[model samples]
Structures are given as C-alpha cells and as structure tokens.
Target chain A: MNTKIENKLTPVRIIAFIFVALWLVIAMFPFIWTLWGSFKVQADFFSKADWLNAIFGFHTEKQTGGFFTMDGYYGSWIEEEFWRAVINTSIVVFFTVLISLTFGTLGGYALARSTYRYAFWILMAGLIFRAMPHMTLISGYLQPFFAWNVWGILPTTIIVLVAINQPFTLWMLHSFFLNIPKDLDESAMCDGCNRFQAFRYVIIPIMWPGVITTGLFSFLLAYNDFTVTSMLLSDENETMIPAIASFLGTVQEEGKVMYAVAAVVSATAPLFFFVLFFQRQIVSGLTAGAVKG
Target chain B: MKHSTFLLFSLPSLSVMFLFIAIPIVSVFIQSLHIEHKQVIIVTENCDPFGCETTTAVDTEASAKLKEKAPLGKFNGFKTYSNRMHFAFDEVGEAWKSSDSFTVFTKKLYNYPLYRALSFTLTYTFVVTPFVLFLGFLVAVGVNNLPKMFKGPTIFASLLPMIVTPLVGSLILFWMVDGDGVIGATLQKIFNDNSLSLKASPVLTWIMLMVYGIWHLMPFSFIVFYAGLQTVPQETIEAATIDGASKFQRIRHVVIPHLMPLAIFITLILLMDNFRVFEPIIGFRAEAHATSISWLIWNHLRESAYPLYNAAGATSMVTIFGVAILLLPVLIRTWRDFKEKNKG
Candidate 1:
C-alpha cells in the first residue's frame, strides 16, 4: 500500500507540495524572524554588513557578549511604560467582551426564536451597519463624545467598541442559536419556565460552545482594534496597538526601532496563544456566517 | 415567544445599536453640512514709545458670539462636498479644459486630494480582493490535499497573518523590507543596487502595500475557503471520477459550482473590508505614496493646529455612501434569499 501510494505521487503532487511548503514559509517566516529578532540588540538586528548577523546576533555578542538580551522587551514594557497600555487593553478587552457577549447572546437568541418579520429587518439593519466603515461612525462619535465630555474614558471606549462589535456578534450568535433544536427550549417553556428562564436554564448550558466562539471573536475585535481605540482614546489611555503605532511614529528620531519591534511581538503573543488554544472555535466562528448564509 | 418577551430580550442590543450606530449615522450626515467656525482676527496698530507695532489677535468676543450662534460651525450646505479635497468639480473642469494629453490630465487630477486617495483606494480594493481570493483558493486546494498530519500545523501557521493585529502584521513585514533589514539587504544584493529600497518610490510602495494587503488578508479567505471545500460531497467526486473525468475536469465541473456561493460570500466580505483599507497604509507608512478614503478622514481629523471636522465629516459621508453602494448587490441578494426561503 505504501509503495502504491508513492507510485501515485505524480509531478503535480510534487508541485502542490512545493507550493504549499513555499507559502507556509512565506506566511511563517516574518513572524519567526521578528520574534527572534526582538531578543537581539538593535545594532545586531539592523546590521548592514551581513543579514546573518540578525539571525545569529553577532553584533550583539560583540557589544553585550551575549547572543540574546531582554533589553528590548525591558525598554518597551518598563521604560516606555507599555505596561499601562497593556493594562488599559486588558480592561477594555475584558469589559468589551463581557458586555458584547451578554447583549449579543440575548439579542441573538431573541432573533432566533422570533418568527416575526421584524427580526429579519433587524438583522438586515445589522448587516448594513456592519458594512459601514467604522471610521465613519467614529467621525460622528467624536462630536457627541466631546460635547458630553465622555470621550477618553475606558468605559466610553468600551461602550463604543461593544456597539461596533454588536452586529457581528449578534449575527454569529443568532446562527449558533438557530442551529440548536427548538424542541429543547419549547419543552423547557412547557415546564412552567418563562422565556428568560427557558433560555437561562435550557439553552445556556448547550450555548457554551457558540458563546465561547462568539466571545473569542469579540475579544479579538476589541483587542485588535486600532482605528476605534486610536480615534476615541486619549494619549494616556492608549492601548497596545495605538501605543505600538506611536512608537513607530517617533522611532525614526529616537533610534529605538527595536522597542517598537518588541512591542509588536508582545502585542502579537496573546493572539498567537489565542489561535493555539482556540483554533477549532476560531475556525468555526469565522466560517459560521459564510456556511449559514 | 410573546412580543413583550422578545422585546425584553433584544432591548439592550437594540438600544445600544440605536444610540451608537443609528444616531451616529444621522449625525455624520448632519455634521457634513457644517464647517468649522472661522475666527475674526483684528489687527491694531499701537504706537509704543519709539516705534509703531502691529499686532493681530483673534476677536474673542466676536468668535464667542459666533460660537453661541452656531456651535457646530456655520452651515456650509454642500460646499465642503464640492471642495478640492472631495468632489473637486471646479478643479476637474479646469483640468479637463486645459490638459492637452491624458498624462497631463492625470497629473492635474492627482492634485486633488479626494481623487488621489480614491484612485489608490479603488486600485487597492479591486486588485487585492481578486488576488487574495485566487491565492486563497489555491492554498485551500493545496493544503486540503496535504497529508493529514501536516494539516493542523499548516492551518495554525496560516492563521497568524489573519489573526495578528493588522498594524502589527504590517509593521513586521515593514521591518523586514526596510533597507537594512534581511529581506531588503537580500533584494539589494540580488539586484546589485545598493540604493534599492521598497519605501522610497511610489510604484514600489504601492506594490509593497498591495503585497501586504494580500499577505494579511489571504489567510482569512484561505480558512473560509478551506472550510467550504469540506462540504463538497464525496459521492459527486466519485461519480465524476467514474465517468472518466480528470482531476482538473472534476474540480472545474463539480467543485467550482459547489463553492460558488461561498466564493460570492467571501467576495462580498472582501469588498467591504478592502474598501476601508486604512491600517495597512499606516502600518507600511505608505501614506507618502498611497492613501485611502479612511486614511483621508484620519488625516483631516488629526490636523494638530485645527482639526478639520467638517472635512472629515464630508469624507466620512462619502465613504458611507461608497460602502452602501458596494453593499447594495449583497443586500439585494440577501433579500432575495430571504424571500425565496419564505416562499419555499
């Protein structure tokens, strides 16, 4: 069987393998290079005489007598106070996910259960809203946020992020709810449970997978957001993305490009782990809408 | 469920959407009509000691009264929309009449901010969307045929580009392609041109930005298409094979039709997403060579001395209109789908 399978490996199969392997390298090389480069001193990573100097830390050894150093991460996280941005991001992501999931689950469940045309219209409105460039909404938000003096706070940014996240979350959760057999919930309703009670008791347990999937996306949205957070939050309340961006903005003059490089790797580390643990859900969550629609 | 119960369930989401989404949309349109209040500056000459000096100061009292009257700024109607940065009716007209050649006309057209951004945005959107889709479909097909053990790690690796924050992803690629960076040094050596740099010129910058656009977004399409390929029925493939269909023929006749809906779905999503391409421009620092509608709005809003809220609002309105136009077909298709389902 092994010999027969090997015999069937034609030129086309070889080409396909080669192509896939090349793409895999293309996809993974930058990240690995940057992650490794982040541990080297700036001079070594940016060495012009030899590119291998970046991979091997030759210059860094000459200066610090070490192949690797944590100085970049230290300078970024401690000296530049990237920890504050990390803290702000954590707070924002935590609240945004919690609030969006809560509302999204309830709203999505309601939409799924309802047979009325209004639900369809609401979903349609959500589709349109989701399609709008977020910056457009931010433009409107700036005025009212300024007038009301609620522009820069964490809660305000969280609320805005939640609102922006709602359409996608609702749509995802709605589909998830639709997949659950209605008979399960109807029986709970027959057992003297109110609508909310049925949802809470009958549906909530089975809804974890979908909720987790939706919550993962919400977390990603809030955590990865740059346009909204950058526009809404003030300098002091900057999140990791905007903070990293500011580093780039001034790094040319400061000769601190490695600091920004370290921060980029730092910001990407959580997402790397996120995909690792939640790969199944992330895939399902992404394709849920496409498959259902 | 009872209507009241349903309402109770959806009330939180509905109210939040209303306050944020609906209201802001209305306010964008309203704000687009108004421009910033221009201060009345008074210049006075005061003879002091040996010399007469002229000082110019904003008439604070007049400005304060103007602020009280129209706090959002003076109502400019459609003036902002037609200005040089936006529609540029006048500039276009002048360019149209005076330019003797197409190249000169385009050069003149590039002078308008809106046109410049629009040209690059449309190019990026149209170019990136189709290329990513094609590349993604190829990868999905290639990866699906990989040995099972390689599948999981391949997917995990591919997800990095799509899942990493766009700015960070672009920055990672940006650093790699910088003059002294590894990729850059290699390119310089290969070309034997020491001055070779990707970021210095417009054509190269645009290409790099497009390359970044494809690199960052192709993984999303790949994952989506990979999932889509799983649903292709095995029986159909076997039947096609039994009928003496070649691999290419089977894919063309069976798989392509099977995934057409998904293809369309991804296309719609890609169009909308690419239409608002902003982060890559910032990440690549390609603003010197290319700009998008969203970036134009950011530029207006980020003006340090005087934020052009009105200009930003107008650009926002234009972007909203563009998105709506792009969404119309998808909306119609969705509506038709709903109607067909209801009929069935």
Candidate 2:
C-alpha cells in the first residue's frame, strides 16, 4: 500500500530500530568513554573535565581549546611494568589454556565415547569448579601454595587458572565430543587403532571446533583474570588490569583530567582487542558451546 | 573396553578437581567446626573501677588459648557451630555508660556474627538474582532480534563490562558514586539543584551497588540468553505466526517455552553468582555500610580489634551449604525437566 512499507521501513520498524540503537549506545557507554579518555591530552583533559561533567554527568569542565593526544595511552603501554604484565599474562594464559584444553578435551572425549558408571559424578565435579568463586578459593584453597616456598607467582597463577578453567573447558569440550558421533571412534578402533590412535585419527579433527572454542574461552578468562592475579601477584610485577587500576588511582590522586585519560585508554584498548578478534567467536561459541555444554 | 578407557581418560580431570575443589571445601568445612581464641579482649571490671580506661589487661580465653591451635583440639564437635549460631543470634544487648552494666546477650534477637551476615547475603541474592535474570532475558531477546550486522557488535559491547575485573569496575563505580563524583554531582544539579548527598542517605546506601551492579550482570544474562535463543527452533515460531499470532504471543508461547532449559541453567548460575557478590560491596561501603555477606566475611577477617576470621570462614561455609540446599530442589527439577524433554 505504501512505498515506505514496500521498502521495509514502516514506522513501527523505525521506532524499534531507534529503541534498540539507543540501548546499544547505552551498552557501549563505558567503552566509548574509555576510548574518548584515552586520546585526550593532559591540559585539555583537565579543562574539559567540567564540560565532560555536564555532558557525561561527571565533574567534567570544558577547557577553552580542547585537543586530543595519545600520550596517556602510549605512556601506559610503554611502561616496563605494563610490558612485564603483558608478558606474564601471556605466558600464564598460554600454559593455562594448553594444560586445561589437553586434560579437559581428553576427559570430555572419554565421557562422550564411553559410559563409565562414575562418569556422571566426574562431570558434576568438573561443574563444581566452574560454579565455585575464584576469590573464595584464592584465600582458602590457595593459602597452602602461598605458604610453600617452592611455587612462584607465575606458577601459582597458572595452577589456579588451570584448575578453575579446567571444568569450563571440560563442560564445553564434552559437548563438542558428544556431537561427533561415537560410531566414528568405534570404527577407528575396529581398524586396529588403539584408543589413543582412534582419538587422534578419527575424533580429534571432528572435535577441533569444540577444542578451539574451549581454548578461546580459557585463554580470554586467563588473560583477563583479576582475582587470582590480585591475590597471587605482588606489586613488583603488575598485570594489565592492576596496571590500568594503578594509573586510574594515580590520576585520581593527581587530577580528574588524568583519571579520565587513563580510564579512556585502559577501557578502549581491551574493548577493541576483544571486538576485533573474539567478538564473533565469543557469541557463537558461548551460544552453542558454552551455555549448553 | 570403552568404559575402562573412558574411566582412565576421566581420571586426570577427576584427580585435579578432587585435589583442588573438593579438598579445599573439605578443609574449609573442617576449619569452620573448630574455633580457637584468635582474639584477646581486655576486661576492665576486675582491674579498676576508678581508672577503668587504663586499668584493663588483655587476656585470651582459657578455652581459646590452647597450644595445639587445631580445630579438632580447640573445640568439641558441633561446639563451634553452636557458638557461631549463638554469636549470630545473640548480639551485645545495648551499650551502657558503664561497661560493667552492659551484658552481651546470650539470646539476642540476631547476633552480629551470622545473623547480620546471612541477612546481607539473603538480601543480596534476593535482590540481584531476579533483577539480573529479568533484565538479562529482555536484553537477550532485544539483541537476538537485531540485524546481523548489529548483533556481533552489540554482543561485544555488552560483554565488555562483564570481562572487566569486578574490582576495577567497583573502583570506577566508587569514584562515580562518591559525593564529589559524577553520579552524585549530576543528580545534585538536575533534580535537587545541587542539594542531594547520595552517600549520606541510608536508603541510598546500596543504590550505587544496585545501579553499578547492573552493568556487570546485564552482560552475563545477555550472553547466556543470546546463546539460549539461538537454539530456539525457527519452525516453532513460524508455526505460531502462521496461526495469526502476534509477536508477543509467539514469543510467550513458543520462544520462552523453548528457552525453559536455558532459563533453568542461567537461573542456577546467576543465583550462585549473586550469592557471592563481594567486590562492589567492599568498594561501595569502604567499611561503612554492612552491604553483603562477602563484605561481612572480609570485615570479620580484617577487623584488627577482633580476630573472628575463623568464625567468618565458618559462617561462609554455613552460607554455602545453605545455598546448596536451597538450590538443590530447583536443580533437581531442572534435571528432571531436561531428562523428560530429551526423552520426548
């Protein structure tokens, strides 16, 4: 009846679109603020604080002539402590994912391929780790490790991450393994392949998607972990979050301008990093592999 | 043969879980039962009535000052639990002008120990769980129905808050919620004309927590629900539409019904998460408002004047067990539903 209707642009649809669009913006507010803060120059940030206050409902006052720079972002990135944290986080995440994936995927496959009487209990136990709070464990369960002279921060972080992340990976990977029909594994076994070979030749390729998703989930969690990192890590070697946190606090102490700048920088970098790579996987993997599993 | 292989394969995960999760919970269980005198309080009455302030000498309780310092030797079985329950139920009756006149009640309405902690915990879970789930469900539906291009971006944007450390989020929120900060200053200007002190109002004490908490929780619900929504079969919705059903009808009848399993799962997860909420409470209160159970636990552990750390830990275990028992019925129902649905 109407050209607009034919064009799939009805009033109802437009209103719905606008409503969703607003929601989306509100959802992205923290990230946007972080990004904006990251690029603002020190003096401009200070002067703009008042304006930002009015605009963002904070104590932002406008500077006479506001200009943007990348000083804070670059400074945070270049700091030796920041770099060490980056390196440490990377190393820890790598090992944690590797170890968790190997054991979780292997166990998941076993549960999928066979029907051990106690398989249900093991599956449920793995879930308990996923459900338990990391913070509670850090103070109680991890106290013994802190008491020990042998295990260092990096090792301890890895161990904790691996232990915590294992159950999630197991739950996820088990579903993945389950999706790959058992007839394939059985056929391989019939063809003179041992359990290991059958797993390697037949099941591994099929379950690769699940494995990748589990690894991705584990990696992200390990990389961004704050609780375990906070409890286990000392001030000498900072992680990404604590580094940003220190910057935010220091700026807060000095001036609100610097605080805004640090907030923007720290917030934007991780967000873009996540959006650029993990966005699709995070959603799809979460939907198919994470929730159900 | 496959069964044995499966058992062999499961052993590594089983061993790690047992050594880590099971053992620690057991140790915490054990720790809660045995109480030791970790705190020493100075009693003034015996020393001097005239110079009461300077007269008191600190001494440990005979029951608590044991050398072994193990839970087993410190208190009898169930003794620690009973004492904890007593402390939870019995609070110091009322402060008196003279310390000697005040009697810490043996049968208080609620003890400062577990009663306060439990109250905070139950309130936290009750408030957050329902709100998070409801908001999460709505946001998930909204996001799920978005155009393909916006879907990915929306998911990422929503999830960013969730991925950030709770402590960091708390700190940021703390700055914003402080009297001189953004939220306070803005509300002061707009509604009250620079008159409102958001923090000073007892009613508004937990407001920052509820508002800031949404930022963390919305993403979790969104992600979980989004995942769940993906599994809702298109045909079911189409069939409802073919019957001249409205969008609301289709969603209510078909979509929500399809998401029952997911709803159950997410409910359980969020229930657990809400129960343990700690960081924001700590960040918001900074040791002022008795906010949530985790904060209460931290308070007890951190109080230099009173070393009630064991008591706090014990109370936490009790809370944990209570939660497990509470959720057990829902979990059982969900499992049964899942099984019945799967079979059908």
Tell how far residue B321 is off in model 1, in angstroms. 0.8
Per-residue C-alpha lDDT of model 1 across residues A4-93, encoded as one tens digit per residue:
764476777777789889989999999999999999988777777798888889878987778898888998999999999999999999
Q: What is the lDDT of residue A135 in candidate 2?
A: 49
Q: Number of the top candidate by DockQ?
A: 1
Tens-digit lDDT track of model 2 for A1-293: 53443346545456556766776766676555545544554443222225363334232223323345545545655642356667776688789888898888888788776665466656665655566665455435433564465234677677777877878878787777777777887898899999989888887777766777678788777776666675566665556665554565465566544543464345436645865686767666767743553
Q: Could you say which candidate leads in lDDT?
A: 1
- TM-score per candidate for chain A alone: 0.96, 0.83
Instruction: Tally clashes: model 1.
Output: 0
Model 2, span B174-216: residue lDDT tens: 5555555555556666675555665666557665676666777
lDDT of each: 0.91, 0.63
lDDT of 1 at B171: 91
Docking class of 1: medium
